[model samples]
Target: MEAQVFQALLVFVYTDTWPEVEQEDEPAMSQHLLVAADRYGLERLKLMCEDKLISHIDSNSVATLVSLAHTSSVPK
Candidate 1:
């Protein structure tokens, strides 16, 4: 993915809305999510939620990503 797309995805995943996701205007939040999901290996889940709203990023796949994101501090 392009750097801009990656950055946009990060913003989308962390923010609550498209407008709140970033100060600069860009493509739709869904596009960012799709790119991010592909770059981050969450394509399957991202596609599942493609037609949904950006606020639905907390679904199963995202939950898994959230868990994985915190796994570094988890005891093995």
Candidate 2:
């Protein structure tokens, strides 16, 4: 689990998927990083994950997202 998270973080940190080519991000990717962020005291990374999760939230996923946020000890 930690290995996968580390790999994803590697991609996120090193790759420059941008205006010309957007990143093919997985929904759970940011969530995984959120855990690592908390564990390692990566504040900027945590904020980035929070922002990503916020943008992905919607009516259909609100309940699940809220639950995940609570589980992660994130502020609502």
Candidate 3:
């Protein structure tokens, strides 16, 4: 499987949420999880990813994250 898919499965198998996983500043990993969650219509999973993303928010990257959120159709 592709890396993104593998990462999503890892999120499910390893932790209750993506933030709980120890990826450590891996925004790409989190992004993958968010996309997978959205694609699968897993609202809980998507929210978990969104919450995690919010937790990591910093001024410098906030715009990028917001852009990602918009592009991904993440909820407010």
Candidate 4:
């Protein structure tokens, strides 16, 4: 996990909430968090990160997002 993502995960663990992230960073942060969430078996956090990713889907991001979705242990 990245330092930023790891910090966010720790915050979520302690407070049951994700720390604020910049709008432009949201998608990338969510992707990292999704993987970390799965690795740590944090199902609810995984879903939350998935939801964040879903909202950001667009032509510019679709290819990378699809690749990540296919390669990672993100739910199908």
- Each candidate: what lDDT? 0.48, 0.67, 0.69, 0.87
- Report the poorest 10 consecutive residues by lDDT, candidate 3: 16-25
Ranking of models by TM-score: 4, 3, 2, 1
Candidate 4: C-alpha lDDT: 0.87
Which residue ranges in model 1 land beyond 4 Å of their true spot? 19-32, 38-49, 52-76
lDDT tens readout by residue for model 4, 1-76 = 6799989999889988876899989999998888888889898898899889889989998998888888777767
- Per-candidate TM equals 0.31, 0.64, 0.66, 0.89
TM-score (C-alpha) between model 2 and the true structure: 0.64
TM-score head-to-head 1 vs 3, winner: 3
Off by over 4 Å in 2: 10-24
Per candidate, the number of residue pairs that clash is: 0, 0, 0, 0
lDDT of 3: 0.69
Give the C-alpha lDDT of model 1.
Answer: 0.48
Residue-by-residue lDDT tens digits, candidate 1, 1-76:
6666666565556763332444233224544555456556654535533544334544555764455335422222
Give the Cα-based TM-score of candidate 4 against the true structure.
0.89
lDDT for residue 53 in candidate 4, whole number 0-100: 86
Candidate 1 vs 2: which has more lDDT: 2
lDDT of 3 by residue, 1-76 (tens): 4665666656675675554445674665666777777776777877776767777778877888877778776765
20-70, model 2: which lDDT tens digit per residue?
A: 212445457777788777766767777877877778777876887777777
